[model samples]
Target chain A: MPIIEVRNLSKTFVTKDATVQALKEINFEVEEGDIYGIIGMSGAGKSTLVRCLNYLEVPTQGTVIVEGHDLSKLSGAELRSLRSSIGMIFQGFNLLMQSKVIDNVMFPLLIHKVTKAEAKKKAEQLLDTVGLSDKAQAYPAQLSGGQRQRVAIARALAMDPKILLCDEATSALDPQTTQSILQLLKKINRETGITIVIITHQMSVVREICHNVAIVQSGEIVERGLVEDIFTHPQSRAAKQLVIEGKDPDEFAKEQEAKSKAVPILHESRKIRIVFGTQSSFEPVIANMILTVGVPVNILRASTMDVGGTARGDMILGLPADPASQEKIISYLKERGLAVEEVQ
Target chain B: MTANEINMILTGVWQTVYMTLVSTLFGYVLGLPWGIALTVTAKEGLHPNKVVYRILDIAANIMRSVPFLIMLILVMPLTMLIVGKTYGSTATVVPLVISAAPLIARMVESSLNEVDHGVIEAAQSVGATNFQIVTRVLIGEARVSLVSGATITIGTVLGYSAMAGTIGGGGLGDIAIRYGYYRYQADILWTTVILLVLLVQLFQAIGTLISVRMDKRHI
Candidate 1:
């Protein structure tokens, strides 16, 4: 059975001037022990959707059934208890700046009336799991962003929650720091079998850790599937954009506006994106393809990306103006097990 | 100066110190919770109640708007009921507390409001009760600001305590009035003024030091 199930969930925010529908009929299920990623742009309602899972923001129109309990139907105390069962961490780390790391982690346990000694032991163990046992007495401001996030993770896990919700948890960290945090999360998920629901705008983050992903756009789930599948052959515009940008965000952004002129100018005939999974990445497929086709293909962009920890190579190649050579190259590349799609 | 005059000045110092410290203590006793209520009942607060917030809001505003001297006289009957007199340093405490509580409430509300919203959300996510969020997250996070507000409150209350001298409320203000203004003793007036300044500075320095030390937000 799915651990979390959302059906026809909609959230509408009514202000004085406007009634904004932040989420529209969002539907998805997170299976037990699954790492689910909800990816979107800034205003894509990913945060709102995550908030709905915990009922931090109640949905206006549907049911959220977590662990067989319809969240909206639960009483105040029952809801609170349910909330305690699900841990959440944020992009900002949201730690108590005044409290020591140990104290921050112990906060939820103490709130649940756990004995100080017992809570302390548990907090210490969690800190060890997150690799911050030595920094127990350190204040949050004294730690770096990555360290602070680890403390937050320790605190979230203090309750031994069945599910962990991460809302852009690594957006604030640098690339290396982001990788370390993601690795820590992956480790925790594996060891504890704790289901994790990650909400992020960065497709790279999803590709790095999530097994399944749902792409949100303007309060709707535009596309969703296995991370590898989406990376290889994105069917939706939102998914395709995210996939393309996931390779090089800065260049992709420039490419968006410049796409109208740059594509035609750069290549007179045709351009195709070839995505190679880990198996095909090791072979010199491109080199062999050039020799086999007997025509030089312009490498518009080539980079190897991390797709769920496995290296996947993606390249945008400009095919020759001659139709026969373009067809031959396309057919040859298809025969090699590379996922190819024409780039407009 | 005669030994008798010096002794009287010393008594005045004692009276002023007694009133200031006592009034500040009572002020926080009433103000801290009052401020918390104002904050928690606010529109964006934990258990936002428009009715409770408005009542508290209006009451605090009214108490703060009335000038301290008028409040001293205005609460004279209440003070007479509470302390059986409206003139001594102890009786002056009644009106001083009345005035200080509301101002402290405003300060406390502001301090608690300054706490990051994200921190409160984190606390709520962990299923902390509203009361727990108020006492632990909001109050704990705003401790530095609360201390700083208390310091400022102490200084303001001390100044108000001196103003009580206009009536029969006793303190250095009383001494300065009787000897300095009534008898035209410039030295006594300057001495009382200097002592009051020193006292204010002393409280301020101590408060600042405590606040700075308590602030863990910085390195």
Candidate 2:
């Protein structure tokens, strides 16, 4: 069973004048150690969805199952325990600014009534993991934004949660910092195998760290699939647009040429999008005779890339446009067991 | 002034200090919890209760609106009932505490309100219970503002106690009123004026220093 299962979750907040449906029958499952992402534009109900996952914003309808326990059914103490079990980090890095870094990291453990020494020792290790061991004594204000967020991540990990929910955790950060933080998140995922659910509007964040993504739009999941599939052949217009918007011109052009066809997973094969430039366009001809071709060529989508360099622009095309064409392209494209979906 | 006059002023100064300190301390004990409740039960607070909030708010406002001297007189029967008589420093202390508690409570409530909501949210996200959040997070967060408000409370009550002089509170203010105003001792009046000014300055400076020091988010 998945570690976190959200089924038909819906929430509507009523003001005096009107009722706003924040989430509409959202559904998904996150396996243990999966870096699941919820990608959306603002007001797409990403916040509401994630908040509902932990009962922070209780769903008006449907059930949220975490570790086989329905969160909606929990009472006062049980609910708090449930929240503590699933750690959360925020874009604002919600550290108590007046609290020292060490105290902030130790906060959750303190809530659970752990011994002071034990909490302190765990906080030290967690802070060290986030690369802020020297900042234990510093207050949030005394540290930089990245440092503050690290503290928040460390604090979120204090209870040794099985799942981590990141709500726009890096939206406020610069790109370089975003990369490093992404690395840290990936490292956390690898080392502890903790299931992570990140909510963001930025697709690059999804591409960089997430293994699976659900694109939320207007209170519903429009598309859901593995990260590589979503990146290579995004089914939804929004998801495909996000992939293009986040990648380089060459990569995007390759996707446009491919027009992101129905690679369809065709049985969950590891897919790679190989973009051919001026230098590598003939590379496929070298492998055609060595591999098997399942069907005759049918163009999925193609476009030109303008990287503005010696490569100038390269024609990018989706090799297999449909279920019928996929097998032919796959056998032909495979070389030395290199199974990839070449876009350009 | 002469040495004898300085000696009198020094003793009166001690009384003034004693009155301010005792009244302020007692006022804080009574007012802090009231202030915290006011902030915690208002519309945006942790546990909002409109009925309780309105009643507490109305009571604080009514008490605050009353002139300190009139309140001292009006509450005299009650004061005597509690303290055995309406004379001397002991009886005066009761009225002084009464005069300042609401004032300090209002000050504390307003100051606490000025604290950023972000801080409260941060505390909440950490799984702090309401009581722990109040004492540990809210109070600790608002400590600097509360200290400044306390300074203002002490300073204002020092001024208020001068009006209490008619009842023979006999602090430095009473000395000023009886010796300077009633007896028309110009030098004594000037001397008391200087002393009050010094006290205000001292309180203001110390308040600012502590406030600045305690405010870690300093920006």
Candidate 3:
């Protein structure tokens, strides 16, 4: 069974001027132990949607089922108990700046009335888990952005939550810090087998470690699917755009060849598009083919990028000067499908 | 001035100190809870009861605007019922506290509001109960600012005690009005003013020192 089931959830926030629909009929299920990512631009309601899972925001419509209990129906003490099991982190790292790192990590446990010594021991262990064992005595302001986030992650996990809600948790960090934080999150998901709900605008974030992904825009979910399937065969406009930007060319040509038909694609009139993959390398093969045929070649646009440790490339080419030249280029790229775009 | 007159002035200074200190203590105690209630019932708070917030807000404002001397006279019946006199230090405390409560409460409420909303949200997200958030998160987060508010409230209440002269409360103002102003004793009048200034300086210094000591988080 899915660890979480959200059905047709919507929320409207009323301000002095007008009501804003923050969420609209969102439906999804987070399978147990899956690092589920909800990607969106700011104001896309991804944050609001994640908050609803822990009752941080009450949904105006729909229901949340977690571990066989409907969240909307829980209240007061029962609700508190429910929240204890679902940890949450925020964009700002939200550590109480006034508090020491250890105390901040110990807060949730202290609130549950754990003894001081015990809470301290647990906090220490959690700090070590996030790899900040020595900085427990320092205040949050004294730490670097990465260090602060590590403390926050430790605090969130202090309660041993089955699910962790990361609301743009890496958005405020530097690029290097963001990567480290992502690695830490991935590690937590792997070792502890915790489900993570990551909300972010960076496609690279979803590509990093998330197994399943959902894209939201303007308070509505636009697309969702398994990470590999969506990246390999995007069905949504936004997903396609994301995949294209992250693609690499030589690798892409090879992938296209894998998906190519038995009939040779060599034609004087047709343009060749190359898809890049992670392992695609600098090859003179395409140029060599044109040189061998004594035909002039034209290059349009090309891009190469690696995501999830695999290089992806996409390149568009104009017609070669002759039929044999095009045929030679097609066979050349197709022969290297292991490093180029497979046939699509 | 004669030794007798100087002694009377001494009595007046002591009276002012007595009234100021007692009223400030009462105001501080009363204001803490009222301030907490005001913040909790505010729009974005945990239990945002609009009606209760409005009523408390208006009552505090109306009570705040009333002059202390006038409030002393206004609450005469209630003061007399409680203290059995309308003209003594003990009787004066009732009206002084009544006047200072809302001012202190508002000061504390504003201080609490200065705390980062993120801190409170963080505490709540961790399954903290309302009481835990207030005492542990909200109050703890605003501790330094709250101390500064308390200091100001005490100083304002101390000022109010001097005006309790009209009610025959024997403070420095009572001495100045009854002896200096009535008899045209310029030296005594100047002396009382100097003494009050000194008192205010002392309170302000202590307050700033304590507030600074508690403020570990600059933001």
Candidate number of the best lDDT = 1
Model 2 off-target regions past 4 Å? A247-282, A285-344, B1-5
Best by DockQ: 1
- Candidate 1 vs candidate 2: which has greater TM-score? 1
Query: What DockQ does each candidate score versus the true complex, computed on alpha carbons?
Result: 0.82, 0.30, 0.51
Please, what is the whole-model Cα lDDT of each candidate in the order they appear? 0.91, 0.78, 0.81
lDDT of 3 by residue, B95-207 (tens): 98998889888988898888787677777778999999888788877888887887787678778887887558878888878777788999988998999898888988998
Worst 10 residues of 2 chain B by lDDT: B118-127
Cα lDDT tens digits, model 2, A251-274, are 454666786664655443222343
Sorting all predicted structures by TM-score, with the top scorer first, yields: 1, 3, 2
Error of 2 at A280 (Å): 10
Q: Score candidate 1 by lDDT.
A: 0.91
Candidate 1 residues A229-296, lDDT tens each? 99999999878788965643334556777866654644366989999887786789989999988999
- Model 3 chain A poorest 10 in a row by lDDT: A335-344
Residue by residue across A65-179, what tens digits does model 3's lDDT show?
A: 9777798787788888777788888888877766789999999999999999999999999999999999999888788889988998998888898999998898888889999
Clashes of 1: 0
